[model samples]
Target: MTAGTKPVGTKTADAVVIGGGIMGASAAHFLARRGFGRVVLLEKGRLAGVSTGHSAAIVRTYYSNSITLELAKRALHMFENDRDLLGGDCGFRPIGFLLLIGERLRAAGEHILESERRHGLHVERLAVENVAELAPPLSLDGVSYGILEPRSGYADPTRTTENLVAAARPWGLEPRAGVAATGIRLHGNQAVAVETEDGTISTNVVVNAAGPWAGQVGAWLGLRYSLRWSRESDLLVEKPADFGELPVVSDPGLRVYLRPCGEDRIIAGLGAPKDIEPVDPDDCDPGLDPEMRERIERPLFERLPALSRARHLGGYASLYTITDDWHPIVGPEPGLEGYYAFFGGSGHGFKLGPPIGEALADVICGETPEIDLAPFRPGRFIDGEPLTSAWGEGNRG
Candidate 1:
């Protein structure tokens, strides 16, 4: 594995995960817990070193799709009881989640509320008064209605990834940090090995959970995984005295989303009518710019007028791995026996990772998955079955 000294000894494993972010960590965690022997997780850097570490980490359950909604519900369950499942704390803050839309989408809002109710998500339809009652600092100008999930909130992303890995340590989880996957070694239409920077692992299955770098990894196996990278930025400001405790709020009318960062701050980001702001995931400015901050703060100020007194401390940007359909590319790749494409979180992945990993691990371990993942198969795009959402916004899906 040194200079041209031959690859590190051919170590065999049941599965090789090529990223240590939340998705890869969760996948490896679940795979090991599902009894996959010798599960190896390869990370170029430390766990949650990239996007996961910078995630806003909002845990919301309202989604236009049933699969994502179900997974989100399950994720909430795990977050609420991490001690039982993950055996640790994720620092989940259940301050609730609110989604506000313009007057034009009132019908769509009600439809979504009914749809979510039918999907087992007990979300409440809130009028403007109710919205003000929840977050008193908000000015409901140009707002039509709101959807509230009382149990929804945010969590610590890095801790959740770490705890998931920790819980699976007793189940043969082999986490190889600082080892990057160079490529994939295929054998007759099947992924049989994972090529690393210093070694090659002989494995029947390889998960492309490389986050923003997943597109590059997918190309090694001749797989055309349609993925895009967006530089997602968020800023945290000092909580003004007048700004009361606010829930995670999504104001589609103003194209902004914000949540209480902690006791004394609020984190804000852009919402609908998004600017793609594509960038090279490996090399991009991580600092938030004034222009971007203005885009995030304008809508924020429009909704929460009282926050004008808050001071913008600082913020950073990270990559969002988006797919063609915005939904994650999961399950097996067509014509490939053992390769699984599981990246492209599209900014909403932080909360969805655990449930997705659980189901995908079930697939890899040949067990009955609690939820159906066929809609998320890599071949869905090619098979003309791309998933859709009422919002039709990339991340909202």
Candidate 2:
């Protein structure tokens, strides 16, 4: 784990993780607990120092795909009571989430509601009056309907990742920070170890959980994928001097979402046509401009008239690795034995980390996963399969 030491002969491990964010940390945690004792987790920087630290930490199960929805539901179950699985405080907040829909998507709203009900999600379809009664802040004149998830909420992504790493340490896993993966060592077309910037660690398998930089990692093994990175800025506005409780809210028509960070601050983000390519993952600006704020503020003001009283403190950029359909790229990579890639989660990975890690671990051990992973195969694109879906949030397959 030394920063500048010469590469040493690595002690073989059962599995090696290439990133230290929530995905890698949770994967390592599950692998060790599932009887994979020789596990090593490598982080290019400190654990949760990059995208995971800046995550909006929204936890919702409104996915259009059944596999992903099941994964989110399972992970939520673990997070809802982390004391049993993670063995410490994971900072899970139970604040509700309200998703506003426009007139054009009323059918989509009902379809999602019915699907949630079938899965026992307990979500309710709300009229404008019900929306106002639940949130009591937003202007609902333009909204046709809304969905209320009483069990959905947010969490502190950084703390959750660190807590998982801490829990795995006792199970004989080593999480080494400040080590960057430069390449992969292959034996008979299967990854056997990862060569880092400083040293090489020999292992039985490698898990590509690199978050925003996952595509670069995939290239190391010559596995072609469609993962691409983009930057979205969010304005963290300080609450007004007398601001009251504001639940986490999403407006699909406006492509914007906001949530209360604490008693005195609110976090806001948008997915719009103005999205831009990210320049650098580490140095991207975290501040939002007046024009961008206004773009988000206009719809927000209509939804929450009370937010007009708050002051904009600043904004920051969070990187997203989007695929053609925005569904996560999990499971094994095509033509690469002994390796699994998990990234391009779009913006939903934080809440799905626990289940993703568990599924990856199950694959490594030759066990059938609890949830079907047909929707996340890397070969989907090669076989002329479209990454098409109801939600147009495209990501690497």
Candidate 3:
């Protein structure tokens, strides 16, 4: 049977989540686990086929704000305990993460160190020598120091989304792949159902986790979200035979972040705090551009000199649905009773989606979430309380 076509004659559901990316899958999983009967997840395409699939799924807890730091910390826990918390193995690699601190980023790094420590997160301040000892492949030319998260690493985005949905299947979670939500049916000012190309499913609760297409989804309900789209890319190169294992490295000085993709390949991308390359989410090129490849590789070669002799293995591009504050807009929409806004991850949504979804599920069930999500309220933008970041105007929150 096609996804979401189960229980034979059911045309109704307790909740409907739009977009099958990590955010949507996560929301559906938690809602179903909470015993919200008949939770349906609607996807225009395959699960994690859009932005989530293309993400360089790095999971870390380094942030300047308490809300994000808490959310990220929860995410790390969920990933580490995936079988129990997330329903299955999420392909989490505990390869550690290293943030190279240079003169320009020392102050921000220090702030992150202080914030993370205050939250009781496991973080260490490593000097230049310590960094070199941790990753012998790195050059550390302009690096002043480093911040290390020993448990932070990357995960398989597609696998993570699939696992969440699979874990929730027994609890009445219906995943509707290849189904596009065209509009939201509202009674007065509240969402009542969702209209899709296949058919409409009557539901009281609706969560918008549409990633790059989120702005368009908001318009269906007369809601206007200030979202911008950027084309982000990541490239992989064949790892040298004797290069050995390396931790996920984020170098603000070189403006690049890289990690081991697998046993024989390394993946790299431009770090946050860079210029946003605006794009039409539907029309943006999925293949990495030649110029961008050069830009990403130049820094990769500088950091790990051995990679210069490695072969280019091509790369792909994807979209980052950005908000003005570089943070996700979560929680219930103000005037809409059963509608929730859960998109706009900026650039770091992959790692934050599941934990935020779990907390959002708690909020929807009229219970208090372990991590308060008040800071990410949808109306924060209009209230003139946009979140500030150490690296201003970038996705380094």
Candidate 4:
């Protein structure tokens, strides 16, 4: 229907990427660039029109683990080179990233800081007083220390995803929008084709980048992916004129993330809270509710007093496909050939999409990913090796 999608049925592809979100589009782009043939991407709606469209789209590498940190770090590179390498402007703004932790998480934050330093990243462990220099008119009443990554910032999610689809076009990626993948056609254990509403596309490989709908896709193959959905909401308000510019701040102590929305607005959201509201991905209304608005305003006001004077702007709610360990499940599914599980973003899907997509594409092509993906394999959960984190943080993957 939309000019972006193709009528399926008779078409066959070397690999079929489901979901047109950042994950799927990123995977398709990398797969086609890697010389995979006839890569067709299927999306039920418009590109990046689901959760990715609603994502705050923060890009940072402050992780509690090395694996995700590596992925996030590489993602920054891809975003930086989007125009030359990824085929379009990703709208990446390298303002900065700030992480605030209380006394309870100081030791854990320091541990992660050490790992970041070991990886040769430029980060600084700042005392509480220094936090004021990054975000002015803020409260550090309960904060103990902060970690700053000046090279990290945010991107436009919809543009980045659409650019990925565009980038893959010349490389033979056929993205079919408004076409839902009904099921997976399997021959024995090998995924042979994807059954779509338009028709069947014969394929050997499939990437489940369905975000909140990934759990449903996994069921088609008789695979039970340990996935959960949470309603995450974010709000934007007119930035106080004097606020000028501010670093993207993630305060676990306040359970909020604050970032600049262009030059005139500020965006705020609850950061990796454990009291996740389980919701049905297909049925729930994804809109920021009044109760949630109050929940966000309290800390946001206390953290940045100047923001309270800004005009209130609208905001939205979206789904976070969370896994038990709060990290994503990327890699081949056990006993399922040519099928890779690539969802379960927990909450950090935005920045990790490109790198994880590249790595998963490598795994599917029988090449060693620059980074080992064994730690993110789905089998780890069953093997009792669920990826754990320092401080037991929720979304600081």
* Number of the predicted model whose TM-score against the real structure is largest: 3
lDDT of each: 0.85, 0.77, 0.91, 0.85
Q: What is the TM-score of each candidate against the true structure?
A: 0.95, 0.92, 0.97, 0.95
lDDT by residue for model 3 (334-365), tens: 78879999999988999999999999999999
Ranking by lDDT: 3, 1, 4, 2
Candidate 4 C-alpha lDDT tens digits along 152-174: 88999999998888877888999
- The sequence of per-residue lDDT tens digits that candidate 2 reaches over residues 1-397 is 4432334566667888989988899889999889888788989889987678888888887765577778888977887888777546778887887878888767767777777788888788888888878776677766988888888888888889988888888787899899888988787677777887766777768898998788888888777777666776678777776555666888777777899887788888774223446556656666666777787778677666777777878877667767766767788876778898877767777888888888888888889888876677777766776454444444210
Better of 2 and 4 by lDDT: 4
Q: What overall lDDT, based on C-alpha atoms, would model 4 receive against the true structure?
A: 0.85
Off by over 4 Å in 3: 1-10
Candidate 1 CA-lDDT value? 0.85
Estimate the TM-score for candidate 2. 0.92
Candidate 1 lDDT at 267 equals 89
Model 1 lDDT tens row, 295-367: 8888788888777777889999988888887888888876888888888888888988889998999988888
Error of 4 at 260 (Å): 0.7
- Deviation (Å) of 285 in candidate 1: 0.8
Compared with the true structure, the alpha-carbon lDDT of candidate 3 equals 0.91
